[model samples]
Target: MFGLILDVTARIHYALRGLMPTNVLLDALHTRRGLKWGVPAMLLAVPYALAAVFCTSQVEAGGSGWFNLLALIFAWNALKFLVAGPLTLMRLLWVLGREANARRRAARALLGEGFGPELVEEPVLTSRRA
Candidate 1:
């Protein structure tokens, strides 16, 4: 039945989630603080890409057919890293903007309770003009 197939697929998916190293790394990278490392993580794609190229070259030179699988895996990982970088950077910027907006709202709330409208409406002059 379709229900049995769905149950089996779900179980396999969960099983693989625990076994995959990339999933663990991705979980860590999804955190707010971890977002800052995304740009730097793109550098990791270079080694993976190089490995893929090497594997492909070996296969072309009459190496084992299994090298093609390795090449495919490396290429996939390289693509993931390359894409994660910009996506993470964009997420980081969004998080920072949200935090800034929250801070500004809090400041306005506090200022409105204790200060006059003039103070809230006008910019505070740090220096007096003669």
Candidate 2:
């Protein structure tokens, strides 16, 4: 029974994930190339924030109570984008550092076994009269 419940929950989770529009954007932002653009993407939050403010004003002006829901949604989206930017930047730096270390380790391995820089001989030049 527990296994069946877990399976159903996982299926529902994935179904909901597919329905969310932001899932695609979030997935792209997590990638290596996408990480580099995260700082720029933060600008997207500005529009969301503006929309939220507009909705809030509409609600306060007695436009409609439903405007409050829109305001909350916009606010949440704005916060998500604002926070995603810095998090992605930090992740990008960590990935770059890891890659650099891996490359250094590979190079050291290639230069191992009597192939140290000190063991390399400089080319000797000889002058000859033609």
Candidate 3:
């Protein structure tokens, strides 16, 4: 788990960390604005979903408010993920330290039994622009 996490960090840092001083990228993921946008987005989604379901009409002549509401909510939810979700997940990664850690832990648990972890290194490329 640690190795995978470290490897990801190594890759990001060694690659083009375009954000200013670069070290700033290592800081927490939960930017104030990111949380601000993310929370309301998630909160609004629930009621919108329920409202959509309730407003719709049944099979036959389904042109009811419920159907429209459902469509609206679905669209809203899709938009939310398109914008808000990544921010929240990025915040999660920020708080948790690294995404690779979460994936590694989940992978280990799924594998069960006694299968040890292994290190797989990738070669770094160099350009001779000189």
Q: TM-score for every candidate vs. truth?
A: 0.82, 0.78, 0.30
Against the reference, the lDDT scores of all candidates come to 0.85, 0.82, 0.52
User: What lDDT tens digits, residue by residue, belong to model 3 across residues 1-130?
Assistant: 9999999999887675556331232222246544535545555556655654555534225555556756665656545544555677677658566657766665565445333344212222333363
Instruction: Enumerate residue pairs that collide in model 1.
Output: none
User: Better model by TM-score, 1 or 2?
Assistant: 1
Residue-level lDDT of model 1, residues 17-101, one tens digit each, is 8887766776677799799999898898999999999999999999999999999999998998888899999999999999888
Per-residue alpha-carbon lDDT of candidate 2 for residues 41-111, written as tens digits (9 for 90 to 100): 88989998999999999988879999999999889888988899999999999999998887666556545
C-alpha lDDT of residue 1 in model 3? 100
Error of 2 at 62 (Å): 1.2
Q: Which candidate leads the pack in TM-score? A: 1
Candidate 1, residue 89: the lDDT equals 94
- Model 2 lDDT vs. the true structure? 0.82
Using TM-score as the yardstick, the better of models 2 and 3 is 2
